[model samples]
Target chain A: MPPRSAPDRLLAVLDAFDHDHPALTLTDISRRAGLPLTTAHRLVGALTAWGALERDPSGVYHVGLRLWEVSALAPRGLALRQAALPFLEDLYEATHENVQLAVRDGAEVVYIEWISGRSAVGVRIRVGARWPLHATGVGLALLAHTDPEFQAAYCTGPLPAFTAHTVTDPALLRRMLAEVRRTGCAVSVRQITDDALSVAAPVRGAGGAVAAAVSVVVPADGIQVPALIPAVRLAARGISRRLGWRPA
Target chain B: MPPRSAPDRLLAVLDAFDHDHPALTLTDISRRAGLPLTTAHRLVGALTAWGALERDPSGVYHVGLRLWEVSALAPRGLALRQAALPFLEDLYEATHENVQLAVRDGAEVVYIEWISGRSAVGVRIRVGARWPLHATGVGLALLAHTDPEFQAAYCTGPLPAFTAHTVTDPALLRRMLAEVRRTGCAVSVRQITDDALSVAAPVRGAGGAVAAAVSVVVPADGIQVPALIPAVRLAARGISRRLGWRPA
Candidate 1:
């Protein structure tokens, strides 16, 4: 492996953490971060002393509250999530389904907020998890709102499909984006998982630009798209209103 | 200002942003962080490139999505908030007043989550806001659950009073802590604003230790504290259950 710079090395300590690996011991950190034991020891000490990492009674390290405090200031992360939460909660109460808030990060959509919908279709997404732009409902809604040129670029070869219903053809994907723009919403029916369908609407901010997308994950069988559309749109409008978007 | 270490300088740039100054121009960042123009530019460049900060259309810098995504992994921040949110929502829906979740940070309480009531209160607390352990209802609940030696140290003469009703005497504060522990709840009656009162309860973790606190802020006058106690305790109990706490 190529030797990393000081910043990269330090950041790798943090990089060692992920959804599947939230807790790690010093040996795990050394292995995952590709750091020598001594270097890992010093860096981990700095991180723990700085409260970037917390050591539990079991000597396993997890992300600490201090880093989370600093991170809560991210405008597109918790800031946007903060603005979208009441509406998400309202939608969850209405549907009792998985409610999610997502924003685009380059080619992927990162889940900024999620409320587990235990009674409805089971979705495997967790907070901060990500999926491609064409696979999930939130992803399609956000990708649909992007500029046509970027959309064209995104639809080129290498469209990986997760399920049989996922849109893999370029022309079909273009049509889907158009339909999303026209309806002001995107419905991915069993696109991510075989049994789950999602309906998503674009949320606008003060500038009248799409700020985020909200979606509901529901069972694919016996789905009612028409009925779900208005509720999703209403939640989107509520979030948009709170973001300072008003009708002209 | 003294020259800061490279890491500290980077952290200072982050510390430069807070609730009051969520967005900042380069000049604003340098001035607030007390760093020279050249150094601040270089650092901001690194941070933005690292996805720690995002530059807006107006050239204002904000904490970025990457940081927020990483922060969500913090057990004490988003993780704790996620566990407490449903119960907080129920409390908000029932009371129609401000609902908050907070954790103790040293001698103060740092609010990690907040749901603005339909009729918002006058206290003006936002997420990440800090209050002395002696002032806020959540703070009192957390302080009551913390080590007795720490509570004794906090109750010394340096206790600054917010309102006439604030508990300033060490002896009285000790008595208040005892009552909070005994009753399994805390009520800060008009300790913040004269028009405001807060009812808070401590949330226990799987280990049965007080992990956090939840509370509601309502107008001080004519509100029945006895009536609010059960609701607050129930919400706390619900969150505690989510955190893996069980009644013995």
Candidate 2:
């Protein structure tokens, strides 16, 4: 293949970082990005100078505050989270559980915001983390609102299962999607982690398109599903309204 | 001047979008970045394809979710906010007011997280916004903890005043900084806005250095400074502890 574009090379350097590797040395970046050490050095210098990356006093590189400042402009990132925060806070208050706001990207759901009370059930979700669109409550809520053709194609997959309750069969997933749409909310019971359950609802955007999903995660064994549905849906609707969504 | 670097030109495209200019067309970017239309188009295309920039149906460009995902790795940004969210939540729950987490970036404090109750006093602040290090309560808290030399230089400044109550005199600012250190908190009354007051405290990191600051914003009228100071300081201490800080 031809040489990578300048943008690709720069992005590859950034792609080297993740939740597990937020900090890296120059050599690690070079190796992970598959760039020559010299090339990595030059690109890292450029990035550091541009304030896209920061080099700590210890010489480790980190994604910089400037980059975060720019990224805060992302409509689906800080902007969306900002619009949804009050409602998310309300949901947290009502349920006293973990609350999340996520948007679907391809076949995955990327969490944009998360809030868990001090005594809330412990879950591994973090902002910017991605999970398959068929596994989580937010995923199910978002997936259930997609175009039927796209939904059908998505369900025909080799779905990965995290727990015994995860719906791996396409047929069952399709039926569940239909149910999610019919009921106006999705309930994911021990689908991701066996100890947790999530109740979610779709959020609409300015044009009334399903733009995101909101959910509450709680302990699986003693969840009050009946009580949670309205609270979750109310928060989703509140966020949707904040985003200029209006029901027809 | 030497020819602009490829990465710089690409970054220029991104820099064209700011708070007031979140959406731009190709021509708009070209003019803002001082590049020819063709060059701007090429860079915009590369950025869009790489998922750094997004082009909407209306042909306007926006910062994309992918960039937000990458920026979430910034230790001073989302990562720090995530770590402090629990404490911030508690502070909000107790006060039912605006809570903020900020870190000093150069001479400014960049707000990384914010939580305001729906009926909270309307203080103008959003995530990723910045303010000078001597005006806001969070800024004063962060500024008070920096090295003496840095603090001295910052205090010798061209401090901008937002309201009549803003402490613009260098000597007065110095005295305030000393007081912040002595009291373990900073209180600003109508510093940025006429009707707002803020109380802030520094949050120490694992190395026992002040890493970030947390604050509560409330209405200036009928304010109880003594009552709020301890709550704000407690939230800051709680976050600092969660970050592995211990009393020296």
Candidate 3:
């Protein structure tokens, strides 16, 4: 392979950080980025000077506030979350459950915002968490609205199951996606966790396309799935409206 | 001046984006970054491929989701806000007021989280928004907890008044900060806006140093400063404990 360019080398230093290894030493970054120690030191110094990475007193490096400030401009990230927060808050108030807003990223759903309700059922979801498209309500809602060819390919792809209830059969998952499109919502029962059920609805963007999904998770046992559908749809519609979506 | 390094050239491409210029064309970026069009194109291409920036259908560029995902690891940003959210939600639920969490950056406060109450008084604040240290309650709370020498220097700096009620005199500002330290809360009455009053308390980290501030903003008229004091302080302490702080 050819030698990495300067831009690639710099980006590699940033790529050394992730959800799991958020903090790292210079040696860790050098090893992770596959760069020489001297090169890593120079690049890290530049990144720290530019405020993309910060070094703590102990010499450990982590992502910095300036990066967060810049990333806040991502329309599919914090910008979307900021627009949807008030409606999410309203939904949280109405249901007192774990509310989430997520967008489709490849074959997975990336949760951008999450509001945990006091006394709500415990769900393994947080901001920046990811779940497969066939394994959660928000994922299904987003996948259901994608291009037919993309959806078809995803349906035929390997569907990892978190719980036995997670949909694994391509035909059954396709049918569920059909139902989601027809009913304007998706109900994922014990898909991610054994005891949680999520009801979700698609949020549209200004161009009449599904841009994101909003959902609420509750205990699977004694869940009022029917009662949740409308509330979830309303919040989705509220966020869609805020995003400049208009219904015909 | 020394010639710019490769990393500086790349960071300048990112620095072209801000709250005001979230979206930009290649030419805009080239101009803003003070780079030649060809150089900007190459850097932008690298950034896009690395998922730090994204190009829209219209050929405009934006901060991307990958950057947001990486920035989520910022301890001073989302990590702090995540640890503080439950307390902020409880505060919002208890008072139905606009809740804010901010950290001091130099002589300014950067709001990392904000939950706007539907019926709460409108305050000109948003996530990632900044205000001077003396013009907001969270700013004052954070400022009062800094090293005495730093605090003294900041107090003596120019205090630009927002509203007529903003503290402009260095001596008065010093007294106010002392009171904040003594009472463990900062109450700024109509400092930011004529109709808004904010009560803030500092949150400590594991090392017993103030890391952030949590505040609730209400209308200036008919405000109960005393009633809000304990509630705000409680929330701050709760977040501090969650962050591994222990009472001395």
Candidate 4:
């Protein structure tokens, strides 16, 4: 890559920290950020003083509270999660299943909130976890609502299957999206995990555009999809109303 | 103000967004960050490209999902809250009141997680909200656990009163801290609000140092503080154990 701009260089320092590398030493930051040791030192110092990064007594740097505070202002992040929590809680109360709220980021769905039910089927999802647009119930709900061009491209593009049950054929996946749009919900069984099945619905924003998706995941065996659909759609609609959406 | 370095200028653009001003225009960013308009434009563009800031259809810039995803890695932010959520849920279930988890930042307590009961007393607190060390149950629990010299300095400092029942006198505050230390929990009545009572207990980390506090807020009238203490302390201890704390 060509030489990055000053702001990009600073951002590179932050980008160096992610899910697998939440904590790092100065040397690690220098190498990961592609900066010299001295440049990394100076930028790290600036970030530390500004509270974007914090250094522990062990000399490892971690993301800081101030950065988290600022990010809490993200409308797509905590704000949406806060508005949807009560409904999510209600969904969990009604179904005793793993409840989730997620939004589309490009071709992927990013989970913003999750409330696990102790006795529910085990899920491979957590807050900040991501899944491709075709692999999860929330992902299917969100993908079904995207613009036609994007939806077409995504359907025709590479679809990685997580299990034998996952739909990898473009024609079949397109039909699934259509069914989701028609029925107002998506149900995926044993796609991400063998025992888990999820039912999800799209949440609308003020502009009546799909802003997020709400889902409840349970054991694939011995569960009724029809019984789960109403509760999932109700929670999604409740969250949509909370986000300022009104029906025509 | 003195001229800032390249990284500082970049960080200032992010610092411009907060609870009150979550979205901003270029001019607003320039004014709030105290940077030249051209410099602000450049920095904002870089941030937007890096997914740190997002611009809407109407030209307003808001904090973005990428920033939120990264902030989730913060040990004191979502990571801590994630570990404590199950215990908090149990606390809410048992007490049917508002449950909260907070960590001290300077002399104030910053709420990291909150679960509100539908019929619970109205609380002014929200996630990422802050309150003085002497004005909240979580704050008192945290303050009582701090080192003696720092705790003494904080006790002697000006105590801002939120209601007539708030303990503003240094001597009284000291006694309250002593009581909290002896009881292993803090009971603060009408300190931050006129109609609520809170019982909080400090949560310890792997090293057995106080890392956070868990609390339950309920209607102040006709409630038994003794009943709430065990649940609150139990939730705190449960969270501490999840954080790798072990009792000798």
Give the candidate order by descending DockQ. Answer: 4, 3, 2, 1
Best by DockQ: 4
Model 3 chain A: lowest-lDDT 10 consecutive positions: A221-230
Predictions' DockQ, in order = 0.62, 0.83, 0.84, 0.86
Per-candidate iRMSD: 1.7, 0.8, 0.8, 0.7
Model 4 chain A: lowest-lDDT 10 consecutive positions: A216-225
Candidate 2: residue B69 Cα off by (Å): 0.8
Query: Which residue pairs collide in model 3, if any?
Result: none
Q: Write model 1 residue lDDT over B1-248, tens digit each, in one string.
A: 67655556666788798888889999999999989988889888877877878999989999888778777778898888988877888898888888899999788899999999567677758888889988889999999988878888888848888889988889989999999999999888878788988999999999999989999888888556888899999999999999999999
Tens digit per residue, CA lDDT, model 4, B1-248: 99889998988899899888999999999999999999999999999999899999999999999999999999999999889988998888898899999999899999999999889999999888999989999999999999999999998888998999999899999999999999999999999899998999999999999999999998999457889898899999999999999997
CAPRI quality level assigned to candidate 2 from its DockQ score: high
lDDT, candidate 3, A48-84, per-residue tens: 9988999999999999988998898999998999899
List candidate 1 segments past 4 Å from native: B1-3
Superposed on all Cα atoms, model 2 deviates from the true structure by an RMSD in Å of: 1.7
Q: What tens-digit string does per-residue lDDT give for candidate 3 at B1-248?
A: 45799999999999999899999999999999999999999999999998889999999999999899989999999899889988998899899999999998888999999988779999999888999999999999999988999988987888898889999999999999999999999999999899999999999999999999999999999647899999999999999999999998
Global lDDT for candidate 4? 0.93
TM-score of each: 0.95, 0.96, 0.95, 0.97
Superposed Cα deviation of residue B165, candidate 2 (Å): 2.7
Q: In candidate 4, what are the lDDT values of residues A76-130, reduced to their tens digit? A: 9999988998899889889888999999999999999999877987899989999
Model 3 CA deviation exceeding 4 Å by range: none
